[model samples]
Target: MTTAYLYVLHGRRGKIPESNLELLAGFIADEGQLGRIAFLEGDEQTLEDGIRDLQGRPGVDHLAIVPVLLYSATHIRWDIPERSAKVLDPSITVTVTEPLAGTAAVERYLERTLGAAVTAFPGRRVLLIAHGTPHFPEPFEELKELASRVGRTIGVEVVPTNHVGHPTIEETLADEHGPFIVERLFLTDGRLAAKMKARVQAIESGDVFLPTLEDDPVIINAIRERLAEAGV
Candidate 1:
């Protein structure tokens, strides 16, 4: 049997506050299946190196890197593959899985993260916030579509806004009537997420601020589903 190993590659933030990548790494390792997590941004060695280190214990033949990324950004398209190739082993079959977006997996995560807000206030609006880069806007667009899908599923008015693509998040926060719930929509709790959270705090009616995708247990299943979808 050719053993498989899963490396959950995470985007770089200043630190590992978002998913507690280190903790999840341990969790997946302890699960003792083909599950493992690697935060690309972490100071640890590359996925290939990790597999090489494991060579003595088990003769692994397959490796899959499940991107813990929320966007289809450059990191997904370029950085991960390039680095993986640099450290590739001729023996191990490597697979880079799809980035998470516009799927039932994401909707489930939204439900768990914001389930409390679904019925917390009778008429509060849901503001889904995401970030974008000047070079590309597709990431934000993709997230907007996912937000709409989630809103329809939950039967709520979801206003999709971007922190970088536009100032729409501020507009959504200012224009929305009465109390509103803010969901900082990203995996990492980095500078931008922090700024958005602070802005939400400034709003008197921004009563409920749900957790970001970082360090949440629900994320594990979501990643697993994506990996399964890719036949990992």
Candidate 2:
């Protein structure tokens, strides 16, 4: 079945964030599979457009809406699916992949990031930050669990928190052992990531920021694997 890869990004005013565009282009490059990719920055391309385009293609039966987000939060359970459900037809099968960090793929990414940060800041702790919801506290718990698993894998201590969750970065940085390494569990350098990074840096000048998942070979490979799992 012919399938299209729909990239759902956290963009504003329908404009592709600078670094995100570069990362997306890179994701469609040599090593990454799913050559036919369509970027949807916020509402850049509505579900109607995607469904129409796919329906126009002969023999097309599947559409994979793969969110490049790092966590399985509200966006995964609500926003992305709600939007896609609007235009999906019974004739076509739709598969939306799980958020990035929850999958096994993230294990390697987290381990690699922790390993690198530890190498640079030998005695520092890891602060794994993600955008979490307040009322729906499950995601925060997921982040905490993920952090613990990653910390165990790499033999380090990880402190997980949502931007608006308890134990704010300031608290974590201040209360936790000094010289904390701020690791971003994000997909791109969007406003969310940038603002949070700036906030963390303002709090602690010496903190280190590990690379966001954006367009990394590992991330792209992980996405590619997810797309293939949609039975494309």
Candidate 3:
């Protein structure tokens, strides 16, 4: 059976974010697989639209959907599957790969990004930020665990917080009076990320802000690993 890879993510209805997805699709396509991009939210190409487009292609019998998400939360575990199932043809098999929650590539990226901050500040705790969900706490919990693991390796305390949920970035950094590092787990440099960046800026000064993940190789490799896990 012929399989096509679909890179899906939360859309922000902007050209740059869409371009980021296009770039990711290009990288995956270089691996000799047919690929497409879709959005789960916003006004861009929808997941249903992408499925239809792929189904229209000749000899495309199966779809390997790799959600470009940071964690295996509601969108990965429920939304994608439900949305894809509704539009998929019975003859076409579909596999929704796991999100990039605990991937080694991500861990490496975090370590490399935070290494400098730890060196500069010595014993200061690092603030790890993620675009968290208010409906479910799994994403926040998962990020916390990931932070804990990375903290152990780097010899520093990695404090994880949701920019939108409980233990928010605002509250976490409220009582802080020293230099700190803020590492974001956001995938693209979109509107949401911009809002979080502004929040960080307003909260403190001299707190180092690590770069956001924008078409980073770690993300590309994580997506590749997800496709591999699904046997695509």
Candidate 4:
């Protein structure tokens, strides 16, 4: 049997979320298995085609559909599995794992990223920006706890801000002073990151750090570690 693992990415159409893809790729690469790894982009056609391909592969005994998302919202918990069943083989054993937000590795990544921001800002105020979801409380709360932990560790005051929901960027920015630095807490350079840059531009005295998806090796390593923990 081939024992291949199918890594499925869940998100909106046209947006692949390269950072998550890169992270997943890194983990698979580190495992030293090339042909055994497969990717499925999010979309109706792609999801169906990917599952069909997996089913046709004679060597694939187990299919682990890992959701490349941050939260366990409707998409990760329900939509992905529903779509998978459309093409999945009954003989094959398939398992769905939780999103990245459920891992402590993500919290560690956030700590390291925010710690660097705190060190750079020194006495200045710092804002950690996250892409929030109103329906999912874990992502926001995990990000907030990360900010608090990093603040306590570095002995600096750090404020956690969300772009879409509660503790919004506007609300957090309103209470902050000048010369602040806004560090993006997202895994990729997408709409959220772009909005954060625009929000920082409106602030007269603050600066923003635009780190690319490949900027931090710690995050890459963390993803690898998480995958190992998952026995992937």
Local distance difference test values of all predictions, in order: 0.68, 0.71, 0.80, 0.64
What is the C-alpha local distance difference test score of candidate 3? Answer: 0.80
Error of 4 at 174 (Å): 2.9
Q: Which regions of candidate 2 deviate over 4 angstroms?
A: 20-43, 228-230
Candidate 3 deviant stretches above 4 angstroms: 14-19, 175-177
Give the C-alpha lDDT of model 4: 0.64
Q: TM-score of the candidate numbered 4?
A: 0.78
Cα error, residue 201 of model 4, in Å, equals 2.8
lDDT of 4 by residue, 14-89 (tens): 5445455555567668766422223344444366666677667767767666655566666676677787887788
For each candidate, give its TM-score against the true structure.
0.79, 0.83, 0.91, 0.78
Residue 109 shift from truth in candidate 4, angstroms: 3.3
lDDT by residue for model 1 (159-206), tens:
777776664556666776545677887776777798887766676454
lDDT of 3 by residue, 1-232 (tens): 9988788878754432553665686796678778778888776688898898987789999888888888877888788888888989899988878888678888888888888778977767788889887888778888888999999989888888787878887888786544677787888776777788788788777777777888678888787677777788
Report the error of model 1 at residue 219, Å.
0.8
**Candidate 4 Cα misplacement greater than 4 A, ranges:** 10-12, 15-30, 34-45, 102-104, 210-219
Off by over 4 Å in 1: 11-18, 34-36, 46-48, 51-58, 112-115, 171-178, 188-192, 201-205
Of 1 and 4, the candidate ranking higher by TM-score: 1
Per-residue accuracy of model 2 over 111-166 as CA lDDT, tens digit each: 98788878777878888888766657777888888899999887788988667766
